[model samples]
Target: MRLQLNSSSHTPLYLQLEAALRERLASGEWRSGQALPPERELAQQLGVSRITLRRALERLEDEGLLIRRQGSGTYVSQRVEQTLTALTGFSQDMAARGLRASSRWLQRGIFRATPEEALAFGLSPTAEVSRLERLRLTEDEPMALELAALPVRYLPDPQAVGDSLYAYLDLHGLRPVRALQRLRAVAALPRVAELLAIRPGDPVLYIERLSYLPDGSVLEFTRSHYRGDRYDFVAELKGGK
Candidate 1:
């Protein structure tokens, strides 16, 4: 790719470089998963210092537009966009995009509610809850790690849960009518990094949700860690026109 740097411009070299690279990606000059040119060669070709080039690249990596493997080279990232206005399960979201969603159950059993869970679900201190943790995937690619809890009254048989938790609930007429969700960005801890296949300290989307039945009874409490490089969440706001 031919990139021109305006030495006469007041913009910092790194920022200019970042903008140019971003434009290239936006224009489809480099497709997802395509390896970028080596640092040394590209630095020399652009007549910019290695530090400047690396800074620009690092910014992109942080924004989830690129991935840099330790020994392997850097490549463009493949990401998915999710809308925040809908209350949907991982399987349903993936299906809407024509992608297959699957999960690997990590833990499932009935357990006494923790202090936090008890408060969030409005259960008694000694109340029992069914907890389920799984690694959610799309097209076999690791996407998010989910930990969900429900009142034992609703999900008595943890073993009966399958690929889609919502489907399981629907069959038993326990499907929730609405949900409240909160999302924030967090640095992945070591174990979370291992499960998501990203380096520790990498950015991830941490989401917590509470679902409610039509009668306003709390139905589910779910916490999810989504891969920052592979996902984007969008929200639409309306103002007086």
Candidate 2:
């Protein structure tokens, strides 16, 4: 549907256009990551000058509702702000924000631990480990690619896991009480970009996490690649006493 600008209102044309576009996003008329019509085409459709439409688009971009790629045009941003202070599962986080969380499994099973996985899990090279690899989704949109490894004793049946690995661990009394995480910015590789629906070389957040059980045993070693455009990691700081 074409968005109509209200000329009779006291509001500025650009502001009116911005509000209408925001409504379209809020109402799901424009889905997350969906490209917007070309500037000229959209301006014509809205019966507004290019300048007015540009101004409105700029406003939305500033507010993190739109992303403007140099050669790819504008797309609706699927921005989800996550707090760094929380030790929560993906499903729990999405539930807090009233978004449905789901997963598309890429790999799941017990396998002999690779050298790196063996070192991470403190297991022998021949020891088996349960691996769960999946694409995390929120509101049916792909959000992150996660690969997690744990000792087979803790996760004996990878197929028993569901939407949330943390939840599954909790039920088995193996959930982590604390975690150490390292996050870095990396360019997406072709395979990751394909699964994430972004172009290769786009920025992505790479995270490595080591979650510990209450007794300080490592419970999980997880590596994740999150779409940079979709996630904002917020950290809170307070002054020392």
Candidate 3:
């Protein structure tokens, strides 16, 4: 599609182009992960100099609406912003944003708990746990890789879980009341890169969470790797008086 800049408008040329590009993205004219035309080609098509085009594109990149890979052209971003203050499951999170959440199951079964797992659950070493591993997706686009473990008593049938583990737990009255989460940045491994459709060594957000029941016992232990480019975690802060 050709984009025409209003030459007589008071807005800067690059800003006009930026707004046009944003409109296209919002209209779904350019879908996520779809590569934009080459810089030269797009500049010529928009009747603007390469410098103006680059400036506009740079703004979009900063806004997380575009991604430019080294040696690869720019592509539309599939980024989503999430607030850190909420205690919600993946499904609920996506739903709040009007996105459909789905999962590609990797593993779901009962297994002997490791020493660390046993300690986390305050259970005996001989105790078993249920493990659920899956690729979390939205609109068929992979978003995160998750591995969750729970005491077998809480999730006796791992297969019983559907799209949302929290929902399943709620149904059984095993939902966690609160959680402690830690997040760090890490390079994506080859396996993770392939699954998330990103390059190896790309930045990823590694998060570990321990969810607690009302009695203060650990109910779930989960580790997840979120696509750094696709996730913007926000936190609201209040200043002290």
Which is the leading candidate under TM-score? 1
Error of 2 at 155 (Å): 0.5
lDDT of 1 by residue, 1-241 (tens): 4467887899988999999989988998888668888999888877888999999999998888888888978888867789989888899998998888899999999999999899988889999999999999876768999999999999999999999999999999988999999999999999999999888999999999999999999999999999988998999989997
Global lDDT of model 1 = 0.90
Q: Local distance difference test, per candidate? A: 0.90, 0.88, 0.90
lDDT of 3 by residue, 1-241 (tens): 6677888989999999999888989999888778999999988887899999999999998766898888989999877888889888999999998888899999999998888788888889899999999999987878999999998878889999999999999999988889999999999999999998788888999999999999998999999999987898998999999
- Provide backbone clash counts, one per model: 0, 0, 0
Candidate 3 ranges beyond 4 A from true positions = 1-41, 48-75
**Candidate 2 structure quality by residue, lDDT tens digits, 1-241:** 5566677889999999899888889999888768999999998888889999999999998666897889989989877889988788889988998888899999999989989889988888799999999999987777899999999989889999988888888887776888999999999999999998778998899999998988888889899999887888999999999
Candidate 1 vs 2: which has more TM-score: 1
All candidates: TM-score: 0.79, 0.75, 0.75
lDDT of 3: 0.90
